[model samples]
Target: MAKRSLPILSDGAAKKILRDLCKQHNVSLELVTQMIEIQRENLGRGRQIGITQDFSAAIAEFLDSASIVRGE
Candidate 1:
């Protein structure tokens, strides 16, 4: 049997990839970082039962509006 290994990404590489993705998507890295922080805070608040419905709804609304703005 042949063995295969997955390629590992360093922190710099990961950050560059994320930056490239943000650029490609026409979104600012700061906006993406803020979204991540919001999600993290929600997860902390709802750790016992997972993310709250309100948080999920907010995320859905955000995505919906983003798509609308981008005409996607």
Candidate 2:
């Protein structure tokens, strides 16, 4: 079997990607960061009881609703 190498991004590149994504979505970096933390916490809590959910999609929907509510 051939060994496969994983792609890596430098810290600067990662930050740039995040910044661009936030700009493209017209959302503040702080808001996105907070949502990510909340989603992670929820996922962790769910895992304690062996519950699994497609939280990524849920988070996206939440962000959309939040943006609409904020008139963004």
Candidate 3:
């Protein structure tokens, strides 16, 4: 699949999304927000956050494995 760009977010939307992700993952949104801020800064400077694509692919692969295991 082709890579896609995610947009910059206002504080509210970013916080909301981060909160939802953290809740789903049983993580702390504060920590996730730190990472998001860093990613945003890197993206703003036109530097690709290296390995993000690979990371995404890896997550997809992991989920695919689970789905297969579950006969999904």
Best by TM-score: 1
Clashing residue pairs, candidate 2?
Answer: none
Task: Please give, for residues 16-58, the per-residue lDDT of candidate 2 as tens digits.
Answer: 7887988997866665665555555555363534223444555
lDDT of 3 by residue, 1-72 (tens): 543444433467866876787789865554454456546555545657564774465556656866798799
The best-first sequence of candidates by lDDT reads 1, 3, 2
**Candidates' lDDT values, in order?**
0.62, 0.59, 0.60
Superposition error at 61 for model 1 (Å): 15
The list of candidate 1 runs beyond 4 A from truth reads 1-10, 47-72
Score every model by TM-score. 0.48, 0.45, 0.36
- On residues 1-72, what C-alpha lDDT tens digit does candidate 1 reach at each position? 432321222367777888899899886665665566555555535363544564566567767888998899
Clashes of 2: 0
For residue 22, give model 2's deviation from the true position in Å. Answer: 1.0
lDDT for model 2: 0.59
TM-score computed on alpha carbons, candidate 2: 0.45
